[model samples]
Target: MLRDLSRPIETGMPTYPGDPDVTLAPDATHGADGYATSRFRTGTHAGTHVDAPRHTLPEGEAIDERDVGEFAFDARLVDLRPLEQREAIAPEALPDPGAIDDDVDLLLLRTGWASHWGSDRYRDHPYLTAATAERCRAADVGVGLDAFGPDPTPTARGDTESPASDGDEPDGTPAHDVLLGDSLPIVENLCGLDDLPTRFRLYAFPLRLRGGDGSPVRAAAEWDD
Candidate 1:
């Protein structure tokens, strides 16, 4: 079976704190121009997007610099749902190394947070700790999630302050630091994991935007019936 794992790009879709707001405007009317085109302005990370090493590491590789094969993921979905608001996803929540297959190159975290995609609660979605990101790095796998990012997002829109709760404070973008620091891709704003099998093939190739720190992708997944 095949399923789309991407969030549709539209005007006014929720974006990360301080990121550019998305806009889609008609550039030419069908009646006037006899052809249609649109003018869209959006941040590279807006909507369902992938993060490249350049997203965090100043010396890291941009999305267009990496080999396209890396974007095709041999993915494993790990469920960690029912978490509390703004909860941290600790390393222990991941499956043991023994349970992982050598063929897996990406780990998609299912926190059941996609249900809150457009609400304020979406920003409060569960997040991965630096430790969890380290685990994925050591395991040689990239990270994906149903929420905004692997790191805790600020609950308020346009707030750039790092999130703090229960006495744990992440250095800004720690998960991105650990993962992208190593050139591992981070996919975010994914949806429909609840309908996918544990193991699947994921394709989320980004546009060949030269020197792009990141890019929005048409992410999709497929699994044997």
Candidate 2:
């Protein structure tokens, strides 16, 4: 059986401060007189979204070329609920890098922070450290997270502090520098990961928007017997 871990984006769904709030303006509705139609203007990274390599790499491949087959492979979920604020996920947090078979590709990090999937809890959640990103890059693990961003903090001056000085670094340099510089694609804002077995088959496919920086995805994974 397959379980979906993606979060839904709704009219009052949590979003970054400056990002547009999700709103529905009904053009026509069955209740009024006809079929329903609406308009949505939200951030590309809103909700459970996938970040293309181009999102960080200056010349990296767009989301279109990233094959869905790549995601439909062996996977494992690492729990990180023990981590406290500002604590980075290091090599020790991972299973024996060599113990994982060559076929494994998808590496899902479940911080258990999804309990606060939205709201301020979504901001400055635990993050992958530089070493963690580097190791994943070396291991060739298709890394994704159930947090806001790979960076525990924001890169811009006022971004992280906007949520009221949660001790997050004002400059989200280290996290982004490693993940983006390595051309790693990060999937964020995932939920219900705790419901899936640690080992499973994942099938996450992003939009094929030609030359586009990134696109939202309906990512899913299946459990084994």
Candidate 3:
């Protein structure tokens, strides 16, 4: 059976704080243009999307430059629900790395945050700590989460400041750095993971836009009963 793991991208859908809001307004109607079409305007990272290395590293490979095989892989899902709001997930929050098959290239975490997708609470969902990213990197698996991003909410860090001055390393984005630095793609805003088994095959190909930092993906998974 195949289960769609993508979040529906529609008007007023929840988006990252700085990202543009989704707008799916009709541009052509059957009576006017003899066809039905809608105009879509949103950030590339909107909704269920993949993050390429260029999302963090300046010299990193863009979405189109990476191998197509990177997006499809053996996946394992682990539940980390009941995690407190704004909590930073630790390595212990995941199952033992040894329990995962060596061929498992993707590790998806179900944080139960998808239930709050359209509310302000979605911004406060739990995120992975740097240690958790390290663990995933060590296990040689890409990461996916059902939250806004992989890092904790910026407000939770008690710093309301914007990006630091030039030549200063930005803080509070280690999860992206660690995983992307290793050239591993991250899929965020994934839904329907709760319906998947512990092990499945994932196919999440992004738009092949040249030099694109990232692209929204229609992530899905399939497994045998």
Write down the TM-score of every candidate. Answer: 0.94, 0.84, 0.90
Number of the top candidate by TM-score? Answer: 1
TM-score-superior candidate, 2 or 3: 3
lDDT top scorer: 1
Q: Assess candidate 3 and give its TM-score to the true structure.
A: 0.90
Query: Model 1 — which ten-residue stretch has the worst lDDT?
Result: 157-166
Q: Name the lDDT value of residue 79 in candidate 3.
A: 86
Q: What ranking emerges by TM-score with the best candidate at the front?
A: 1, 3, 2
Question: Tens digit of lDDT per residue, candidate 1, span 76-139?
Answer: 9898877987888888999766678999989999999999888777887888889888888888
User: Which ranges in model 3 have alpha carbons more than 4 Å from their true place?
Assistant: 155-170
Q: Write the per-residue lDDT of candidate 2 for residues 1-225, one digit (tens) a residue.
A: 877878776787876556667764667789986688877767667777777767766787677777766545577788777666445677778766687678777578888777865545456577776777777767767577777777764423455543444453435446555665665557777777876787887666766778766666677888765
Model 1 misplaced stretches (Cα beyond 4 Å): 157-166
Model 3's alpha-carbon lDDT is 0.84
lDDT of 1 at 144: 90
Scored by Cα lDDT, where does model 2 land?
A: 0.69
Model 2 vs truth, CA RMSD: 3.3
Better of 2 and 3 by lDDT: 3
